[model samples]
Target: MGIFKKPPLRGGKRNAGVPDDLWTKCQCGELIHTLDLKQHAYVCAHCNHHFLLPGRDRIELLTDAGSFEEMDHGLYSANPLGFANYERKTADLREKTGLNDAVISGRATIDSFPVTLAVMDFKYFAGSMGSVVGEKITRAIETATREKRAVIIVSASSGARMQEGMLSLMQMAKTCGALSRHQEAALPYISILTHPTTGGVTASFATIGDINLAEPGCMIGFAGPRVIKETTHQDLPKGFQTAEFMVEHGLVDAIVDRTKMRTKLAELLSYLMPQPSLSGQETLG
Candidate 1:
């Protein structure tokens, strides 16, 4: 009935409800371009809010270009508890996240300072620690010890994976044991706690680092404020779980923004680990 049937709107059609890919809404109620946010290391320009970076993104952000050697790249969970639909869940996450497990362990260089790093991603099952995660982290730490390189763990987890039951709990001990050996070897270990680092992670290796760093506005604790308040039956102080509060209470050594993390880590590594030369190679301590 109409001329040319309205031309069919031409080339392509976009979903009406889909949001623009270039823009993102910050938690502080600010609209920002995704590329601009990334240029700022995903920190909100308006509110200085630190946005969550993917685990692999973090590795790229902190490491020197082309200097990451990943360990246990093919490792994955085995559904040890025979949890219902666990395999499906893991497979979905693996496909979705393109990661074998929640944590990515490897050797990397920050400002060309060699170190062993394990970064947790909340995108995969909230970055919960399972047997694979535990083994991978333990192996990373052991590698650092053998190579005499500093060990760094960036945690963004809801804690241990309950789907694996005791197998998951066992990781706490296993990771801590590896850290102990790393410690006895006199190698420095740094723990960087991002938002929502809690539960069995906080109980074990998360809290036992030689230097503990937390991100601004991040919540770091074993139990959440709600659970603590319900159990204690007392009004907790304001900013109870914030990184600033943790620093004030001596739980965290310092609160560093995400933008400054790589530089700060380099500085700390340079200070704690003085090298004979300016090379990025590992030293035998």
Candidate 2:
């Protein structure tokens, strides 16, 4: 009989399944490689840590499969002040991140509970809040209110955009105003703080959630640790403004891992907006 050669295995690259190159130790410590990090829902596998995710990814993770419908997709920024390099910067960021602005606003369902989602994309100019971002978010809030759906704002921003000057700063108040309206309507607004959520974004609606949640190990504060330390000339507290710290300080309602976030959010929404009790109505008779 002629010698029979073994056929190749059904699955190619057995070792490829292993994520050996999916982690790297950075000066800040071990950071998971981006692809592997994403697979783990932006959580660091090395330390069981959570990293900041882009706006698009956050929406995808939070929303039910194929349930998201984006709102305010036509918005774009114009060079009103003619700030130096502003146009170039915006174009560069858009090209790099494939996003028009720092924030993405949309409607989606979390475990069948309707919700409005606004997620900040740090990849776009460090997810800086500007007039456009503020407008989009405000529109989202209004839509949610009209639709009677809960609102979820996921923040991962550097701060206010400087190129827009005071205009960017005004966004702080504008976004807060929109969130305030939602509060007045007794609508639930949940803020999920991701890594490095700071500055105007943090000072405004990011911290204004009726129920605030944060990913594990996320930096949640108004300012960066370095700036604070330099300004105060003192050593900051251990774990400083991390999500764990915020939870301990009662700043955040819970420190949930990405894996559990969707389920937890859905449960919370259910409690806050339960279906009308037909059983109770029948019993009342």
Best by lDDT: 1
What is residue 155's positional error in candidate 2, in angstroms? 0.2
Candidate 1 global lDDT: 0.89
Error of 2 at 43 (Å): 1.8
Candidate 2 segments whose C-alpha is farther than 4 A from its true place:
1-35, 276-285
Q: Tens-digit lDDT track for model 1 on 41-110?
A: 7889999988888888899888889989999999999977789999999999999999999999998878
Look at candidate 2 and give me any clashing residue pairs. Answer: 22-33
Mind giving the per-residue lDDT tens digits that candidate 2 earns over 1-285? 334666665757777877775665644587557677778787666677665576777878888998888988768777778998888888887788889898899988787777889888888888888889989989989888877788998888888888888888998998888888888888888998887899888898898888999887888888788889999999998999988888889989898888888989988998876553544223111
Q: Which parts of model 1 are misplaced by more than 4 Å?
A: 1-21, 276-285
Worst 10 contiguous positions by lDDT, candidate 2 = 276-285
